[model samples]
Target: MEFNNNIPIYIQVIEKIKQEIVTGKLKPGEKMPSSRDYGNNLGINFNTVARVYKEMEMEELLFTRRGLGTFVTESEDRIGQLRYEMAKKQIENFIFNMKQIGYTKKDMIKFIETENYLEGDE
Candidate 1:
């Protein structure tokens, strides 16, 4: 849960929580750590964790039970879909940037091949 100085802290926190949920570390309907607990665990401010939770709630990825605690939503597929969409958007942006930099379709294909190989190695 090391915070990146380049990205917004809350967004990073959101990604961490989302990663946990997607990886089955936090299962459907499982209670998440409280804001205070998360903050302590990550050495971040409680308000930052709170904001991340609030954003997740808006996205329907989490729900808070009055006094019980926030829990990962039961619709795990929705979270998966959201992650897919986000990754798609990022890749689209990368392609657009490459095009802007005058990369040809062949070059793009080669780059993708290299990326696939690298990813496979991982």
Candidate 2:
């Protein structure tokens, strides 16, 4: 995990884990690595990883089962909400860039519905 100097490392780690969760890379109820182990693997301080776990727990994204370790929360609604938020952000950025280059709303919609756009994406 490469840390960006401009952003807080803990926040970056949280975003990465959130992306993993929303993308289904980390399934609901999946067990996560122990803070110490994860810190060692990432070569960061264990306390920082512990902070991440605590923040996640506070957000109800993860739950700790005492000695059993922490596991991802089984929240389908949360996952759906996250997916929606991510898609909305991407679409907003795409629209902003398109409009900057003189594309109208209709043009954007037409392009999105056309085979040319699909082929360009491919």
Candidate 3:
């Protein structure tokens, strides 16, 4: 995972994990990599990976089974909530950026309706 100097690395990791969960890329109840392996894979410190897991568990986005490993939360409702929150955040960011460029709410709505987004499909 590439690091963004402006933001804390742990935050970036948490966001990516949340996105994966919301998008179904990381299935509910799927066992996550052990902190050591995950740290190695991401070329980050083990403490960092541990911190990520701890924070996620605190958020109820993950759970750890004794003697087992951390897993993605299995609650569909929780995942749905996460999805909605992520989308809302993205929209808020978009609105802020558009306003910064002197675009109003009406302009944003108009652009959304008329823009050819096919060229930017990812």
Candidate 4:
């Protein structure tokens, strides 16, 4: 995963894990890559990945066992709800920015529709 320079590395790592869950690349109850393994894969420090995992654990997105390693939480619906909330916040921010730029609601809707169509074409 390419880390963005603008965000903290840990945040980027969290986002990568979240995206994996949201996209079904990582399923509920699935084992996640270990900090060392993920660090090696991404060419990052193991501690960074560990920190991200720790944060996610605090958020209840994952659970860990003493010797079993970290796994995605068993609550798939909870994860989906979290992703939905995150997407809603992003959409709200986008709408706010669009309004600031003088875009009407209709214009924003049309733009979104067009973008969705183009994305489907991909």
RMSD of each: 2.9, 2.9, 2.5, 2.8
Whichever of 2 and 4 has more lDDT, that candidate is 2
**Cα lDDT computed for each candidate against the true fold:** 0.88, 0.90, 0.93, 0.89
Cα displacement (angstroms), candidate 2, residue 91, comes to 2.3
Cα-based TM-score, every candidate? 0.79, 0.79, 0.92, 0.85
**lDDT order of candidates, top first:** 3, 2, 4, 1
Off by over 4 Å in 3: 118-122
Question: How accurate locally is residue 26 in candidate 2, as Cα lDDT from 0 to 100?
Answer: 98
- The residue ranges of model 2 lying beyond 4 angstroms of the native Cα positions read 97-103, 110-122
The prediction achieving the highest lDDT against the true structure is 3
Output the better candidate (1/4) by lDDT: 4
Cα lDDT of candidate 1 equals: 0.88
Q: What local lDDT does model 2 show for residue 47?
A: 93
What lDDT is reached at residue 35 by model 2? 95
Model 4 agreement with the true structure over 1-122: per-residue lDDT tens digits: 77789999999888888888888888999998899999999999999989988999999998999899999989978898878978998989999999999999999989988778567565
True lDDT of residue 34, candidate 3: 95
Candidate 3 lDDT by residue in tens digits, 18-93: 9899989999999999999999999989799889999999999999998999999999999999999989999999
Candidate 2 RMSD computed on C-alpha atoms after optimal superposition onto the true structure: 2.9
Error of 1 at 9 (Å): 1.0
What are the clashing pairs of model 1? none
Best by TM-score: 3
Better of 1 and 2 by lDDT: 2
